[model samples]
Target chain A: MSAQTATIRGWGFLAPAVLWTLAFFIVPFVVMGAMSLATLDGRTLVWGLSLDNYRELAGQAYLARAIAVSLEITLTVTLVSVLLAYPLAWIIAYRVPPRWQRLVLLLAILPFWTSYVVRSYAWLLVLARDGVVNQTLMGLGLIAEPLTLANTRFATVTGFVHFFVMLLTLTIYANLVQLSPNYRKAAMDLGANAFQTFRHVILPLTLPGIMTGAFLTFVLCIGDYITPQILGGNTELTVPQVIMVQLGRRADFPLAAALAIVLMGIVTLAYLAMARWLRLDRL
Target chain B: MPWAYALALFGFIYLPVATLVLFSFQNGSLPVPPFNGPSLRWYGDVLGDDRLVEALLNSLMVALGSSAIAVALGFSAAYALARHVLPASALWRALLIAPLTVSYLIVGLGLLIVVQRLGLGLSLWTAGIGHVVINLPIAFAIIYASMGAQQQNAERAARDLGADEARVVLLVTVPMLAPAILAAFFLSVTLSWDEFIIAFLLTRFDVTLPVEIWSMLRSGLSPRLNAIGSLVFLVSVSAVLLLELTVFRKRRR
Candidate 1:
């Protein structure tokens, strides 16, 4: 085929996807960006360059608090999930029998197939006042009364951590299994103890993978609505919850768009910070 | 010691699900502790509820429909980029994959704005569109990664033997890449099926299972939620195991 024909055919194949993305994804994003700068004049949208929504986000104590709360919860979830999942991935990678490793990993992430909304609701029940955690504690004489485990930041964090631990385990285990046994052998030959080898050799090699997983955890956790809404019990609002309220109750599209833009900004900052280690295409 | 830790971690991971499934068989209304008779009452209730059943069917349609569109678009894009030399191909690839980085909430909210502005009412079709937007990048990336020199050679052979480009793609390229394509389609379906925020934001009266489940949760807590959740879990895991047994296992041999 001629170069012209080849290019034309290539574009013919590409146009459907490109047009769909541009129309639905790119166009909507640009419109949302514009909507963020527009104002609501008594329920009528006034479209123009105005920063009123952003200013409102800064001035309102609750709105400002939502941003702080989202950051705190997301950071905590990311750190805790990484700390927890890394050890699990290591155990599964090095400790499990080769024949059983796949099964073990699959079992680890099996809960992920459950409905996401249902999973959050499941957490709510598990942590309720008369829930299993409390019942088990009382059964074992660990406490006199049930602790307030549900509808709190702890519940929200627990729910987020549960989902992310599974995700990070998968990503980190993939990274771990890719390393040849030769690396560990070489480190041991250099008179490195197991801990020393892990610290100096394995740790650095897997840092990129860890970062990638942690970044994913951060993005998903920060943007998540269902976990916090169901598990949080309105104790505190995350940014997504706040955005939902804006759209659902107030019909405040401009403000919600502004909040979404803020969310995009935060995710962008995270991406930049972890850009060196991220293998987004690999996912 | 690592085994003990693994056991404990696995316990933590499975506790909620075990509770959810266990209470789904509870004879009582609440899905909490104080175990009662092992019963199928809640499961019966969930299946009998018309709204929940309707939402389940809606979720299935959206999952299958959106995944089909996403896979088709993704496959063509992957094929074009893999085969032909388009100018600024890297930029095009980046654009196609860009949505993977954005949050689902943001994507849904963005589309909500455009849909409302354009006076287009929200429905399952709109929700399907949103699902396609999110799943397309995933399908594209997976298929693109699996496109190899072996398929390229086969396509060339087909072309050399007096076959047209379309025949080469349909007969040679697709069959060779069937595993990747199927994997991408199934993955897309799995994601679209369980998606919450996008469906919640995009749809109106006709909602998906996750959205319906959310409302069920809001109205009150019951074992009914547990029953439906367990059913969804059962369906998803069955699909996954079937794929593992049939597609992946066959490929490995």
Candidate 2:
């Protein structure tokens, strides 16, 4: 085929995806950015360059509190999930028999196949006043009365952590299994104890994997609406919940778009911070 | 000690699901403790709910439709980029894969703004579009990664034997990359099926199962929710296990 024909054919194949992304993804993003700057005047959308929505985000206590709550919950989820998942991954990688490792990992992430919405609702029942956690505690004479585990930040964090621990375990396990046994052997030959070998050798090698998983956990946790909404019980709202409220109750597109932009900004910062270790294409 | 900790962590992971499935069979209305007779009453209730049934079908259609579009578009893009030399190919690849990093809420909100501005109404089709947008990158990456020298050699052989470019792609490249394509499609279906925020934001009266389940949740808790949730879990896990035993296992061999 001629160069011209090849070029034409290549572009013919590429045009549909490019155009779809540009029309749906890129164009919508640009429009949302513009919408964020446009103000609402008594239920009228005035489209132009203005920072009224952003200013409102800053001025409103609930809105600012939502941002704080989202960050706090997301960070806690990411940190706790990583701390928990790393050990699980390590155990599965090193302790489990080779034939059974895959099954173990699959079992760990099996619940991930469950509907995302249903999983949160499941958490609600598990943490409800008369639910298993409280019932088990009372059955064991651990408490006099049922505790309010549902409808709180604790519930929201628990839900988020549950999902992320599964995710991080997968990523961290992939990373762990890739390491050569020679690395550990070499470290031990250098007179490193098991703990010292892990600290200096294994941990450093897996930092990229840990960061990648943590970043994913951060983005998903912060942007998530269902878990916090169902499990959080409205005591405190996250940014996504606040964004949904603006869209749902008031039809406040400008403010919601502004909140979405803030969300994008935070995710961007996280990407930049983890850009060195992020293998997005690999995922 | 490691085994003990693993057992504890596994217990933590499965607790909610065990509770959900167990209460799905509860004889009473509430899906709480004080276990009662295991009955299929809630399952009967969930299946009998016309709205939930409709939403389940809608979810299936959207998942299948969106995943098909995503896979087709992704395959062609991957083939073009892999075979032909396009200028600034890296930039195009980056642009295609950019959506993978963004949050679903932002993606849905962005599309919602644009749709409202364009004076367009939201529907399952719009939600399918959103799913395609989010899933295309994944499809692309998976297929692109699997496009290797082995496939390249087969395509060249086909072309050498008087096969047209279309024939080479349709007969040679596709068959060679069937595993990757199938994997991508199933992954996309699973994601779009369970997706909440995008479908919630993009659809109207014709909502998907997740949205319907969300509304059911907001109305109040019941064994019905547990039943539906368990049903979804059972179907999804069975599909996953089937794929694992069939496609992925064969691929490994």
Candidate 2 per-residue C-alpha lDDT over A33-77 given as tens digits, one digit per residue, 9 for 90 to 100: 999999989999999999988999899999999999999999999
Q: Across residues B45-92, which tens digit of lDDT does each residue of candidate 1 receive? A: 888999999999999999999999999999999999999999999988
Model 1: DockQ vs. true structure: 0.88
What TM-score do all the candidates reach, one by one? 0.98, 0.99
**B135, model 2: CA deviation in Å?**
0.7
Show the colliding residue pairs in model 2.
none
Q: For all candidates listed, what's the TM-score of chain B alone? A: 0.98, 0.99
Model 1 lDDT per residue over A81-200, tens place: 999999999999999999999999999999988889989988988999999999999999999989999999999999999999999999999999999999999999999999999999
lDDT of 1 at B220: 69
In model 1, how well does chain A match by TM-score? Answer: 0.98
As a whole number from 0 to 100, the lDDT of residue B208 in candidate 1 is 97
**Where's the lowest-lDDT run of ten residues in candidate 1 chain B?**
B214-223
Q: Quote the lDDT for B46 in model 2.
A: 85
Interface RMSD of each: 0.7, 0.6
Candidate 1, residue A45: Cα displacement in angstroms equals: 0.8
Residue pairs that clash (backbone atoms under 3 angstroms), model 1: none
